[model samples]
Target: MFVGIIVDIISAINMFTGQVIPARRWMEPFLLHNQSILGSVFYVITYGGRCIQGATATILSFCRVCAVCFPIFYQKLGQPKYIYTMQVLQLFGGGVALVLLWKDEYEYILEDNGLYSVGSDETNADWFYMFVAIMEVFFVVVIVLNNLVTYTMFRLKFNKKNAMKNNGVSPISSQTNQEKQKRESGLDKMTFIVCLVELIYFAYIVYSLQINPYMNKRIFYFFYNILCVIYSTFSAWMLLIVSKPINTELKRMFLIIGGKRLTRSISISVQGSRDNHK
Candidate 1:
């Protein structure tokens, strides 16, 4: 959720900029205009978020797959040492990308879709497109493979249950197993929704910036902007929808807060009424 919030905030900046660019309702915000600090900052944030979020999702799926298919290494990966190492790596790598991208001021020329590194070399335009393409393709391949394997495992479990029933044997499920299954099911749904939304974002980026570069720029840019806003939000909302625990917690929290406020207001009103009467 932390990562999601930060990514959404940065993406919102670009979305806001994109909105202004078209309607010309007001002048461009100084921070986000072309070749400005915000322009480069947005690039690093978006690109880093894009790559890191996808990688994070993949790592989670990979961990689940390890739990199912490779229990030996799963334990190792879940260890505090290993987990901490991975977290450090993500931060370190993201920092590295920040440095590489911001080598000089003009390295990242923030245009409509936020993918051009137009600094000192014209040929690098195509390079940025290719880089984005390559990163997205890597994520897509890993995500699809992990999902397919998970689906296959689920089917096998279903078949085995059917076979046991047919053979006049009852398959026992422990409370622990049931709980784990429920959690996994929620996670599967959440990951699937997030991945689907992200894929749509990636596909449009590739198409507009790479595949069909000559398309109507303004219209495409506007649509991309809309997508940025959508991608920023869809994950967190989907989590609340798919995960009963989180949804319930949020509801309970809000209800408690509202009830307290209402009770306080009622007490204040009653005191005022008593004072007037006296």
Candidate 2:
């Protein structure tokens, strides 16, 4: 996810700079000769990022299900090092496959109106769309199924715990059960949020594709590009928001920074007042 963000930042910089800066004599030859390659690289980066996001969300949902349904097994699976290793491998493999498959789908074309744009070959474009549809379906199915399983397991556990309490179970065991329930509930909510964001983003992609044939206006094209960028960026933000630990840490960091600044300001004000009085 961090790597995806860095790639996106670089791509955005290259995109805007490439447009605003006039083509130089030395650069024109390279651009003209390698436009297709450049287009392929961009296409891979864009869709590769989406693949990583989808995979991350799916993995998270699965982990939530495991944690709720099979606590004992999840103890080993949920270790930070193991999870991080899996994430790294998943992203690396998915990125390579996407680049190999979709890189050739994009081609650079110079229109008669003197505008240069990246155009997709009709056959390859259809394949790309099909690939995206498959990914969306896979992600949604995995997330929904995992969420259902997690919820079912949580309910069973909750009821069992309650029955134990009624049977005069120790207070410590009841407290531990309650804590476990709370943690599982948080994971469930986080999974739901991630799934919701994925669905919304998928819907937007479908809507845009349907309206694309009728969008001949340049202003609409500009807005479409902006929307693509926003959607790509929003995925990372959604992950951060859905993560309880990360959100808590971010809030704590912001509070500490603000408190420090306030204290410094107050101390400076007091020092200035004393100096003036002296």
Candidate 3:
């Protein structure tokens, strides 16, 4: 869930920074072409938003682990409306800050100094990249927590099953060997796939952080942001694929796409059968 929220926040910020920031020319009509104020306002919004969202992801990740490990306690706490509300407030507050900064028309001005370099302080992209780096910290932390929990769950489950079998008191002893194997195999496969996608996301974050410092070169920055876009969208796509409702929708889509010739995947069918049996 932490990763999911991070995915959403980063994607939104990336969209604004990539499309809205560099396209200041198009925004001039909206803000009367006040370039300094525009840059200041957008920079604040982009970076501030990233910071708030990153913090939120860290909190959410901790909450998710607690909930999963202590289901009863989590249930007793009731709904998570307050958490959602806080996220909404973060976004609103960031937006309001941008508006106030823009209204004040704040911008750093240098006196007629000795000289100005090609990439002057006014042209510094580090502010933007600094926020990106901060956001990536959340990504790394959450990824670490997620991988740890997932591996722990797998280890415990595997060990318990093995111990039970060795003691000749297996939980699934009543079931046919083939059925037990199928169920176990499905669980392992699903968990493996989820972990693999997570590793991909972590790799993308690392790649972005490594390249962020060199964003001034047009070709390098262009390709970097392009990768960011792809990673953002693809991560969402992978999560949606695993989401129960979304998976249902995807299967339905495939059925339609295949025009009645496509059968449901074996795992899905088997899971459905177990659900019906229960």
Provide the TM-score for each candidate, comma-separated: 0.74, 0.65, 0.51
Assess the local accuracy of residue 105 in candidate 1 as a C-alpha lDDT between 0 and 100: 55
Q: Candidate 3 regions off by >4 Å?
A: 1-41, 52-60, 76-135, 165-220, 243-245, 253-278
- Expressed as tens digits, the lDDT of each residue in 61-81 for candidate 2 is 777777777778789985899
Which candidate tops TM-score? Answer: 1
TM-score of 2: 0.65
Q: How many backbone clashes does candidate 2 have?
A: 0
* Deviating ranges (above 4 Å) for candidate 1: 18-25, 28-38, 70-80, 88-97, 104-120, 158-185
Candidates' RMSD to native: 4.6, 5.7, 11.5
lDDT of 3 at 175: 53
Model 1, span 37-80: residue lDDT tens:
54456456556656665666666667767877888988899689
Candidate 2 whole-model C-alpha lDDT, 0 to 1:
0.63
- Per-residue lDDT of model 3, residues 1-278, tens digit only: 45345645565675555343443323334443454655564445444554454444445444555654767766754458856664664465355435444343333222232111112352344443444555556555674576467457646756676676677864557355445455445544544554454455445545655654443334433554554455445545644554555667888998797864445566678889999999
Q: lDDT, candidate 2, residue 197?
A: 67
